[model samples]
Target: MSDKRSFIYMALVLSLITIATRATNNMVTTTLAPLGKYVFGFDNLLAGIIDAVVFLSTFISTSYINPTLQSSSRKKAFISANLIIFVLLGIFYLSNAVIIWIITGIAGIAFGLILPNLISSASLVDDKRTAERLLSLYSTSLSISLIIGPSLESYVLSMFGYKSVFLAFLPLGALAFGLSWYVKFPEVKRETHGMSAIKNKGFISSVLSITTYNVPFAALTAFLTIYAIEKFGVPKDLAYFSYIPFFTISFLTRLSMTIRPFNSLRYPLLISILITLIGLTGMVLSPSFYSFLIFMAILGIR
Candidate 1:
């Protein structure tokens, strides 16, 4: 294949897998509390632990495992990670509370394996403009998953059951696994040694900046529905729709950025942070559902 053809094929595969992986993750996030209570007999404390452990394992696995894998092995690594997550989802069907936590931890590790490699792979294109556009499309896939995954899982849960939800999406996992096998990863000229990224000032600042943005977003994803229900007496089904506005606006924002690449990231980044802070404050202080939804939309613009 010509380089351009190869790049297009690879980008499409990556985009599909990105959608699948993100949707799977969001499905788990959306249904986690119910899955814990109904399937695993989990109390609040234990369910929280399961959530924490997945991210803890994710941190460990990404920080340690990704640096060890060669760029050449990223394709194999991605395929292996998807296969692990696929098997883990199957395992979730048979698990009790304790076993579910273990499965979550393993799945987190698999996810850690998936993300870094996926980003690195997406960035492997020959031209900077193509790379940015490909990344933007990949990010848009994340917003698509955010919108689709929870809605689909919620519908599936209402119609079928918890176990059926996982079973229904197992095909997505299978699809990602199959597609992963055909995607080619670029070669790295030099291997990055352990923890070398920490030494770079730019890398450190970027990590800290992103971590700041994601920390609250993570909390929101995990608890927004529950908070809406408990705080404002919103119906369970109604609460689930909260993601629609947040992600829809977010998707549009990213799409705009893709079309007109930011020449000065400084002003936008500053404005995003300011808006996010205001939105978070509004979320805490707001007394009603409408107010909260407005704040969420504000944050989504970032």
Candidate 2:
């Protein structure tokens, strides 16, 4: 294939996988709530903890995976991880065991393996700054999915039971596996550059800082739904919708950053962390709905 044809094919393929991955990201926390309450007979907090099982793995895996694979991502490992994730989704559906948590962990590792590689590959192939704009599309897809996924889950689960959601997911995973086989990413000419970057403490420090910033966003993904429902007693769908404003604000915020000048990422990173902290604090302490909304905006500055 011509290089342009290859890039176009790869972009479409990744976009499709993004949708499926977003679906899984959405299901990880919300679907587990009912499963925990109905099947496991657990209380609200415990159910939320169960949901965190996947996210914890994502954080831990990404932390380790990001650095080692920066200069050269292992495409075969990504292919294998996708295959494992698809099989695990099948096992989760058929078995209906809490071992689904381990499956979630596997999915998390798959995401860890793929996400950084996707970003790194894109940056390597094109303008690094422009790549952020492209990534915004991916993030927006994930954002819109927060709206679509649970709605689909509610309908499918009601029609065919909770297991049906997983059934629907299986084909999507299979599709991702098949499409991943077709993508042809660029080769890296990083032999000397990789050695130089390895010696640069500044580069390592920058990556570590980026990792720290992800901690709060990861925490929000893990806990936001439970915080809304338990702390606020709002309906799940409504609470979810209520929170769309957060991501909307977040989406806009991220978009705005690309055009704006950067003196340092330090200030923005600090601001994002503070916003998340404020939102979490609001979840615990908000005395009224209005107060919570303010906190929600603060939560979104990320």
Candidate 3:
């Protein structure tokens, strides 16, 4: 293949791997809280703690371990990480409450390996504009997975028990494992001025914005279905459907941005913060499940 053709093929492979990895991860995350509460008889605090273990491990791995592995072959790391997750998912099917927490933490470490490599691969191109577009497409793929993952999990939950939800995503783990070999791993570059970039105001603001967004989102992912069932008497299967509109709007927003990115972040960032506040407030005051879904869509805009 020509160099350009090779790049395109690798980009496509990376996107496929991303979709499968993200979808399976989403299934696990969305399943954990309800599974803990209903299946294992965990209290709300325990379930929340179990749900949080994944993020905690991921943070440690990314912040401390990933940089040290920069000289290693990313292709090997990525494949190994996916394989670890695949095995962990199999173990999760048979896991009790205590084992589930341990598995979630290990799986998070695997994700910490996988996710940063994917982002680095997407940014391999030399041209700045092309790199941005590729990153945008990568974001779109993530949104697509977020939409599909919960929707399919909802269907599976309707037919089977919580354990089966983990089984349902096993195929996706295999798919990601298979695709991992085909991606072109980006070469590692040591950054001497990493701290300088961290000192930039743009970088600082972006970090703050992302932190603000993820805190609420993490809470929602952990508790939304439980809240719906307890508060509104939504059926267990249908309770997962509450995520549909939120993820759908998120997918649409990313798809649009990939096609035409904003020229300026100023107004869009401000508007998104405002929308998030209103959406969160509305959800608190919502009297019905349907109204809560509306606010979920609004929150997705952020």
Candidate 4:
């Protein structure tokens, strides 16, 4: 009973940390483009580049720095990463365009460290079923963050300027930092079959499928709100709401999959690809904001 109680407590802590950290991340990524364009008077291309810098730094950190720290203390790494992010959030309020780019890149490195640790912590359980459930819980937490983060930012943007979005997520970053200490990080054996795994057809296909969706998704995250404002001449707050339908539908689809996952990926993958193509086309040629949102929601079905 003690062991079960401990496991449950740890799981809850992990879920809470995931939600808080990922929500702050979502807020930053979704807001940066608009913040750059509107507040800093940047062109769309420059603003998009600023957003891309975050992911670029993240990729560098994940690929190079994270591997060196894998054998270190997960608890310490998690705490430190959260602290880095929380401090960066505070810095955003005083940042110019150049400062914003630099801060976001540093924050991305922290995220690269923190996220993999969360996944590692989730898999510490010996029970396969329990580990799978924990992984699903992690995904659901992320989906929930994606839905709520932008929606909350929209409300904040309605009353305040773009800088306020970063400050608004400060509390969440602090909460995630506080919870990082309670995380249970057990030593798990690392899998050394990466090269062999990459050779598999299933692996190749999965990579392709993920890339197909992620490419467009990443572009939209950086530019969607700006696109709405530019194309439809909507208020910044109303433009921010564009993410609501996209992320809400995404959350619902994720939750349904968690409850009843597909028996076969074949048909679902094919259908999702078709829907994505159609959604992209509709979004480009959308007659109005409502039609663009409808297509955005359609893309979320994947």
lDDT of each candidate versus the true structure:
0.76, 0.62, 0.82, 0.84
Per-model TM-score versus the true fold: 0.87, 0.72, 0.92, 0.93
> In candidate 2, what are the lDDT values of residues 49-131, reduced to their tens digit?
76677666766666565445433366776677678777877776765446766666677777676555554444444655546
Give the TM-score (vs. native) of candidate 3: 0.92
Tell me the spans in candidate 3 whose CA falls farther than 4 Å from its real position: 71-73, 127-133, 191-201
Rank by lDDT, highest first: 4, 3, 1, 2
The candidate, 2 or 4, that scores higher on TM-score is 4
lDDT of 2: 0.62
Q: Rank by TM-score, highest first.
A: 4, 3, 1, 2
lDDT of 1 by residue, 246-268 (tens): 87788888878877889977788
Q: Any idea how many clashes model 1 has? A: 0
- Which candidate leads in TM-score? 4
Model 4: pairs clashing at backbone N, Cα or C within 3 Å: none
Q: Return the clash pairs for model 3, or none.
A: none
Q: What residue pairs clash in candidate 1, if any at all?
A: none
Better of 3 and 4 by TM-score: 4
Off by over 4 Å in 4: 188-202
